[model samples]
Target: MKVRDSFSLNPVGNTSKYTDFINYIDTSSVNAGLLSEVSFLEDEFPSRAQRLVRPGDILYSSVRPNLRHYYLYNDSYEHAVASTGFVLLRNNSSYNTRFAFYYLSTNEVVKYLSNIAELSQSTFPSFSSKDIGKIDLPDIDRKAQDQIVSILSAYDNLIEVNNKRIKVLEQMAENLYKEWFVRFRFPGHEKADFENGIPKGWAYRRADEVIDFNPTLKTGNQTEFTIIPMEALSTNSMVLDSGCFVRQDSISGRRSQNGDTLLAKITPCLENGKTGFVMGMPENEVLGGSTEFVVMRSKALTPHYVYCIARSYYFRQTAILSMNGADGRQRVDEDKLKSTKILQPEKTVLDHFETIVTPIFDGVYQMVQENKNLIQQRDLLLPRLMSGKLEV
Candidate 1:
């Protein structure tokens, strides 16, 4: 059956003007089957904001359908306004909302929508509300639908839990970095003598002196390597997303290896903290990523220390100030980055700092890898259950 027969598209229009602040959801805020963030619409774009979403409504992106950015609204987001780029799907009495969400998020359904967008011939391909309504869906028994949702939601719940734990662990590590390095309160600090606003042996060195920025790696066409796209780097985390495979000739971007740090040098991404520590790659394997990345590898410092420095608030501010270009296309000045001053502690103290934080970072890496595995398992199970190939 067509989706329109089972669901209503953008059914609720704004009846009253929102006098106060409004919870706004944009295309960038939604990922595939997930709502990562929201923006506030205050006295601007009033007409552009019209769709009123309620609990159980699904907001699916209409433009760039290949992105598959969609979200299932709940009570927490009640009365929120979504941009016109979304087609809100509210289930009718004939079908289950949760079941529809899973079906629409399937690989097959997304591919169909992507094909439809391509056929539109627009510069930026998109599908209309009517086009989305015409997409096909299965008519399954309600009882069976609930079972399928239950099965899929279990994995999602566990993933959420892991994500929370990952956040806590990351906070713990960041706090430690600040306490010991930024605050100069490392263990036995009272015994160390301070001279000229720095410890006895510590020195402020230019970033390029201690770190290699965007170094080249040699690889041939036959060599297979992981390609890390800018989208693969999450704004909220330091771990790179599971990357795609490509031959050496196809790789065109900043090259990095395990233990290197990647910083997005672009405007919004730089401000959003799109930094990652390259990990989980095979030993000696070189990975290529978006050219927008400023790949920082350690020379005189430990990799962990270099990563912490790159992710530090001070570094981000300096990078942001160094950015230059047109509005949205602004990029960080690589020379400025290379010339940025970084504090370096004594060798023994640096080693001690590494000893303290290595285990914490290791734990975070494990959790990230585990989440990737969980997502893979959930994706694998989704299509089978949705198609009734495996009974709920």
Candidate 2:
């Protein structure tokens, strides 16, 4: 049925209203994107004008519906204030947030909201309380709500934990970069000079000086192509697909090579950490990706160092600062990439660094790939689990 029909069906009878009514704007403030932890609303909106989050408020993101980001609020965030974008539905202080949260949470609801989400045609998607609360849901009391929420939240928390682990590994790579390159206090630092903080023996060099930059061979015309596209990327790794393929745009204009660094030049994607080394390109006719990827030559710069630098805070900052464009279609310059400065270590030193960090990035990328598998498994299980086709 059409999503509009879901609201009118009045599938839920608890008779909840738009969030604005009970959403007490707290004098307290929370920064919207600040929270990186597992708890919902860890990073909520920043408002000196505070709003209260009672233990039972259901949290939803008005923007970026793609995240499908919805959560049941709990006493853990009792005094927290959410951004205006989120609405807090307090179930008459009697209904459990978890119970209502489960019934309210549905793939159907997300699909319905996404169809009508608000966004500048060029930007991310958004929704409103009228759009939200009006969606269909199963009505139930706090106790049963507790059981459903308990199960879901437990799984959600596990996902959050894995996310945190990924973050820690990311941090470790950064710290290692700083220690060996910035501090210049490596195993051989003592024999090296202390020129300008870098080890005295270490020489400053440009990437162009260290590595040969090979632009990939461009695929021609409007010919059809299949690809294990670089949809998910990191400095060290990327996720490839076999079944999914699309027409090659200028961004998708090039043939991927064994050691290419697939840097997403487009905004949001560039910022979303889509830049990564392309070691996963399948050797076959079912292949070709965007011109957004420029092959990085590791002739002098080892692929490992190339991956590390691309993913470091330094390169990310540079890339972010260099972005330009209007509307939601902002992008970084492919030309500007060559102009970025790079630090080059001695060949042997780079090799050693590669030896140590190669496995680290490999493991991290493997984990990400593993998490991708877990996501598929969990999603496959969702219908069965929720519909009782499969018992937890």
Candidate of highest TM-score: 1
Model 1 agreement with the true structure over 294-325: per-residue lDDT tens digits? 89999999999998898899999999999999
Go through the candidates in order and give each one's C-alpha lDDT: 0.83, 0.54
lDDT of 2: 0.54
Off by over 4 Å in 1: 12-24, 39-53, 75-81, 92-94, 220-222, 243-249
In candidate 2, which residue ranges exceed 4 Å CA deviation?
1-57, 62-94, 99-105, 117-127, 140-143, 193-201, 211-214, 217-299, 311-337, 388-392
Compose the digit string of candidate 2's lDDT tens values, residues 149-236: 5665666566557656767776676678788877776777777766676655467665567655555455545365544344434322
Residue 371 CA error for candidate 2 (Å)?
Answer: 2.6
- Model 1: pairs clashing at backbone N, Cα or C within 3 Å: none
TM-score of 1: 0.89
Query: What's the count of clashing pairs in each model shown?
Result: 0, 20
